[model samples]
Target: MTKGYIHIYTGDGKGKTTAAIGLAIRAVGAGKKVCILQFMKSLAYSEQKILQSIPGITLITLGKPYFIAKEGMLTDEQRKTWGNHIRIYPAGHPPKDYREMTLKGIEQAIDAVSKNYDMVILDEYNMARWYDLATEEETEKILKARRPEVELIFTGRNAPKEILDAADLITEMKKIRHYYDKGVPVRTGIEN
Candidate 1:
């Protein structure tokens, strides 16, 4: 059997989840079964709609309707506009329900890795761990559950050193410049 390696797409830039989805399409095109578990994300993303209909792909999303932001990640006006749709929490103190949900997603991830999938993508999982919604040990458990022939991918920012150490391939999406800096809100087809 062919060996499958671990890949991590991380950093403060955008396109982490996009890269994972691209890979999923490539894998499916190659006649491989792919499973994607989107952590800390709801079905609000337009890609979720298309990903669900693709052959040889299974998509699972585990998140609340609202999104989470760290304190100071947005301006007062931005927060006001996103009020009720965004939860801004301090470091090391994520919302309890979100944490519970992440743990449950981890279980589902473990199950997916143990199955017959050729590739499994844990989208936004690094950010979930960075936000303290999940633990390194729990992430490692999902890593350990993977079959030898199943490729694993994790995407999001601030990936812990432990995760970087375990990865066979790591691609960091550095943000040299972004239109969002000029106050461009997330566009539906591009960012959301």
Candidate 2:
């Protein structure tokens, strides 16, 4: 292709990452190289097992093993149930180590954009910025480094205004309803 544009998949609903993955698959099918950098996520997701083996695709996950929630985002009962599997922190004070790890991941993304990758997906990047794991200025680095032929996709909820403005296309998945609210857990290969 001669030119590629930026795309953002945001909002509280699901399918943001799914859309990005679909695009990656399409790109690969067309003989294009793809790199997916998942921020604030670990390697436990089932998709990673297959994505890692896909030719012409590079998958990198940057996150701790445990989930993280901003203080007050989770109910007391929820916290109790999660126990040591989740970490809750006060607003504006996310874990320093996590933030540092993401910053390095941002650098890797920037480098990937500079390389020959035809498409780059920054999964959960919106949440990373929302939770202060990454800053808009750091995001700017990847934007600035993007080649004209490199497509960039950012996925996750609560995309900041700056990100929305910078995107060539934006798709917000508004949740009309979800089974999770009805006490369903995230099923593997679907919501995980």
Candidate 3:
């Protein structure tokens, strides 16, 4: 209907990626083409397997699962936990490869959109921009150039104002409270 559109999920809270994945699942159920590109997250959760089981849905994970911490932002325990999440590839260091793969994934997603996909999810893409792995300018350009017939969704914290302005629908997950703040670690099937 109306050649599809754009949906943005942002703000400081959980459920951004979960919401996007829910939409992806819905689109697939309705027999629509769907693709999800998750940046900064490696495939380690049950959702990866479940998503793979869905027909007409494709998922691409870009980058190693290293934690994004500013200097002195995390304690040693947090650093260790993050370290355990790091993903290493067989071909030496993976940061460069992650960048290249991400770019390629974006290009491929654009192509899929142009080819008449129903929905595309750029999961945690804002984090990529926030971390300087992807530029806001480039993301803006891509959004501007997206096919009118494609419905796109972007999920992550700190989405730029420009993106919010351009989006047809925006959902912000404001953090009221979370278990993590109560010393609860992210668990599989819940926060992964």
Candidate 4:
């Protein structure tokens, strides 16, 4: 039997979640089942529509509606536009609802790895740990308990060293340049 290794996509750049989604699609296309447990995000992005359309894919989002940002990270325009929905000041202590959602996501991920899916993708999991929404030890325990044939993918920035050391393949997506510097809002089908 072929061994399915653990993979991680981490760094400051984008495309980590996108890459995991691509792999999930490939697995489903090859007649394998995929389960995506999204942490710290609940917005139904454009990709969610397509994921719902995919037959062998199960996508679950356990996150709050608002995105977390540092106090000074939001530009004046952004503050004025999305001030109501944004969370600023001390990104470490996320809202109780978000924490609850992320904990639920971790539980789902554990279940997915143990008995449900051929491939399990923990989207934005690193950030979940960084934000105190999840714990590295609990997640690692799940990884160790997963079936040998199950493929596991963890995506996010600032991945803990413990996770990197456990993963068989680690790819860091470095950010060289981004259109956000050019004053471009996230487009519906593109960045969203």
Q: Which candidate tops TM-score?
A: 2
- The whole-model C-alpha lDDT of candidate 4 against the native structure comes to 0.85
Q: Where does candidate 3 stray beyond 4 Å?
A: 70-77, 80-95
lDDT of 1 by residue, 19-96 (tens): 999999999999999999999898899999999999999999989998788787899998999888999999888888
Candidate 4: worst-modelled 10 consecutive residues by lDDT: 86-95
Residue lDDT tens for model 3, 95-175: 565667667766765676666677888888887776656766668667866788788998999887777887999999999
**Candidate 3, poorest ten consecutive residues by summed lDDT:** 85-94
Candidate 3 versus truth, CA RMSD in Å, comes to 4.2
Cα lDDT listed for each candidate: 0.92, 0.92, 0.77, 0.85
Each prediction's number of clashing residue pairs: 0, 0, 0, 0
Please write out the lDDT profile of model 4 over residues 58-90, one tens digit for every residue.
Answer: 989877778776566678998888868877656
**How many clashing residue pairs, candidate 4?**
0
Against the true structure, candidate 4 reaches a TM-score of 0.90
Rank candidates by lDDT, best first: 1, 2, 4, 3
Candidate 4, superposed: residue stretches over 4 Å from native: 70-81, 89-92
Off by over 4 Å in 1: 70-78
**What TM-score would candidate 1 get against the native?**
0.93
